[model samples]
Target chain A: MKVLEAETYQAGEVHRFEAAGQEFVYLAPAGGIFGISAAAAAVLETMGAAGRRMDELRAEMRAAGFSAGDVEEALEELIEARVLERPRTLPPPRQKMPERFPLQSLVMNLTNQCNLSCKYCYEYGEDKVATPDGKPKFMDWETAKASVDFFLQDSAGRERLHITFFGGETLMNFPLLKKVVDYAEAAAGAQGRAVDFSLTTNATLLTPAIIGFLADKRIGVTVSIDGPPDMNKLRVFANGRPSYDVIAPKIRELLARHRTRPVGARVTLTAEVTDCIRIFRHLTEDLGFQEVGFAPVTSSQKNLVTIGSGKMDSILEQFCALADEYLAAALENRQHAFSNVTDTIAELHEGVNKSHPCGAALGLVGVGPSGDIAPCHRFVDSDTHKLGNVFTGIDRSKQADFLERGHIDAKYDCHTCWARPLCAGGCHHEAYVRYGDTGHPNLHYCDWIRTWTDKCLRVYGAIAAQNPGFLEHFERRKAS
Target chain B: MKHLRAVNRKAVRVAGEIDAAAADVHALQEGAPPQPKPVPHYPVGCTIVFSPGWEVDSSGGTAGLCQPAERDLYDCYATCFWPAQVPDHLNNYPDWTKKCASATKDWREIDLVFP
Candidate 1:
């Protein structure tokens, strides 16, 4: 480990770049972006190299059209903004885990059974723990009601709540899902609150009736399809037959019918299915998905389809290629289908400093078909990570322990990394699958995440510089 | 200040010696002017009000508002209540204030959102 020496006025850790003829600085400490004036830029330059005394920096700022008082004010502002740094007078404080955090959303795992047995399916893969021997294969209406009530009660004073349906194939339990929607709507309505419904499906079981119901209820749908038939080699049926042909027409009907919320496509990128650009094209252009998101498959090291280091590098390159397309579309005030870039940019724009990997176990939790609660969808069937059962309340002690262990402060490897605010040590389930510990950092993707973050930073800088109005429009769309 | 139209009547004192009864020092109250017609070309669902300053508080005064305006940003964004200026973080930008621990100390990190 490298030691930092004492400094009077050191420059803060920042990524500086010029885009669209405007200079920008991404402040590492605060995750803030600032467009410096010429005077502030000069002060940054004068102190950029090494720490300098107040008198010394003031002398230079005086020459740059700043009065003595003005220079002092400017320096203080910079220090406050974390654009300039001073040695901490006190030791850094540890972040405390919040108690009594309310839940905002729940992921309901509809079933442990699936029609398609994707080669890298995490639910049934090597890493998966066998479903509890007596657990039901599909979630029943009673459990679904209990989960909805649990979610609403846990959310307490919340004006709105969200529930996402998940499963080996969410559509496998469509009848129950329909009942839960109506029940949840009436329940929330009685309480003078609103509830939003969304689901992730393989689309193989979607019928005209299902599509019409989804459209009428305005339920958001996310289809899990890799890409065109050629790219979806691993996403096959139980009998080892391809599934693209079956799902494509169904997805088309769903997209055509579902008009309230844009239907998104979630692509699982495996070692064999590494063609991100082609997959993105087929999903967004050919199949007409409003947004397409790609996630590298999560699996144990022994899983053959698990992406190794070399393949991960290639995936990063493909992600960057798609990001460039996103950038081009953004510059012209157009929407792009690359949800990864859009999601990251949104986080960057919001200056998200996550203590945990995500909202899992914090604002969100997952319920299995048997009413057992887990941290998230990925942990639904896993017997190891159950937080509690929906009938009983979430176990506070267990949840606290999981959060404390997963906190950024507990992740030693992430202490010095500037991207920790955005990444927060990567996905918890991925860490658990790869390292046998939920608290372990996903070291394999550190470089990839850092590179991808930098690319997004530049994309944000370019947009803030050239077409800032687009950012406003984007924010409005997101809010709406 | 030059472009802004003064909304309320107030006394303006010149910081210099002046004649007690000087022409510019009169305390006369002027008659109110007729209200102008609303702009016809303005789009519907517009929330932008042509007020004299940034915003007025519930009491119809600026004193009740948070100082420096940024202090109230997180409050407004968090609840998405009365989001006339900042982006609402409740339903829309739920993660907007995730990085902002204390708005007073981290005001610079607050994002600028427009209607």
Candidate 2:
């Protein structure tokens, strides 16, 4: 039926608030906030939070001490605004989702082998999920090549490819990393394509030659460092020796040498290290890392080390202060070097209506040491949730199961959620650990994300209004 | 479920009776909303920019594809045409004038304070 003035429209999950002394309604599905008049607010109040026929609504407002002229005027404004819509029963798909996985980034677990025995290391931690074989691991040349070949075969034609090296310690299998880089780059070049290389490492084994090689290759590197020595108590070497003193210099060295792409510092926030501002400052200002991102430990193990719900508010409070600093700098047209805030706000600014948290089960796959393919790097060692292996091919049935389960369409709770458009159901890894099911949404962090998103939205609003020119950098970033 | 907090609100040039009523409404609600919110404290000269990976659009959701040109205190819609990915997303906000657009709908308005 064509939308007519007579039709009743139910209010969807809308956020109604008064700001700057004006009544504003945030239509979630439409992603708009309109500053309605006092008369309009009174008209909406007559609607009694439920939608009704315009004629009936007019009568209701009339009964509520409103004149017919006022009611008609409000109706005209509301209908013209499309604010009173036909009551969204179905969420509009934000983007055309890919049916077949267009493989781009393949995380290769070169070796489960590690030189460190950090308390917070997931693979070595209390809640470590064992590989199927239940054996200590390392990827062989054949397995690694098959993983590359699988991405190539399955990649539905892409010009650029990404291969991220992962490990108990990636440098433990430096030879494999070198081989894959050499092989993949050559293959890409042969196909008139290109490849980007990146790796996550402990930074304990960075030799000058290795750093030079990485610098020459222009591969992005993410060093896993928590914070200052006192804060990084959980990140210890195998012999219970402090690894910060060793890695801090390596991080500085990496940042100083790497120029093509910014080297990022990754900090895992646990109960052992909840200091957000200090950690961020130490990494960016002290270590001179170009960017830094933080993540609370997602381990399922019940322990004092796990970041419980109580700590979330405090951590988020500290995070908000830093985000403020980031915003303050942006308003002044200065970069604050806060990668997480920068990244989160970037998505909000772009209107990224995400249908899933990350393209974990979509554009990328994680290859285990033994050549098995899982949904992502976090699930590489899980007995269940394993998609398939490169040796044979992806188990389409299993992949479908994950895709169906992980899609926002399948999450019942997300249907009416205001933040669902962006969050899509937090991280699959977090969901699995927190809820014991990869398909479930990460409920533990829901409030945190919602509040954080609101905070970022406000920051975006302030920046967009204050310094409109600074956003040109976002476009430049894409072109680069 | 949403109520304005009197303490949090800074009475930005609204009429007298309504402002007092808004404060009364807020007082009825329990506790206060989160603090250090995105209240625009920066003055007129502070120029804002887009965060990385984001582009200016006329609207949000499926209709959020129109590229916007940066104006002195706001971003204005440059082209009437929608992005190829969202070819149909044009003039989503019926309440606004034709060329007006915002980064997102989280703001109260899209003027000098939030565009």
Which candidate achieves the best TM-score against the true structure? 1
lDDT of 2 by residue, A1-480 (tens): 123447787554555555334566544554444456666777677666678777677667777887766666666555544455666666576454466768878999888878888887667656666554674388889888888888888885888888999987999999989999999888778888788999999899998889988999999898888889998888887789988888877777877787878888888998758888898888888888888888888777476688867777888998889888887898788887778788876665554556677888788899889888888888886778788888988898898888778888778887777777678898887787667777798776778988887776666555655675776777576554
Q: Taking candidate 1, what TM-score does its chain B reach relative to the real chain B? A: 0.35
Tens digits of per-residue lDDT for model 1 on A310-406?
8888888989888888888998999998999888888777666678889999999999999999999988866779899999989888888889878
Estimate the TM-score of every prediction.
0.76, 0.73
Provide fnat values for all models in the order shown: 0.00, 0.00
Worst 10-residue lDDT window for candidate 2 chain A reads A26-35
All candidates' chain B TM-scores are 0.35, 0.16
What residue pairs clash in candidate 1, if any at all? none
lDDT of candidate 1 at residue B109, scale 0 to 100? 55
> In candidate 1, what fraction of native interface contacts survive?
0.00
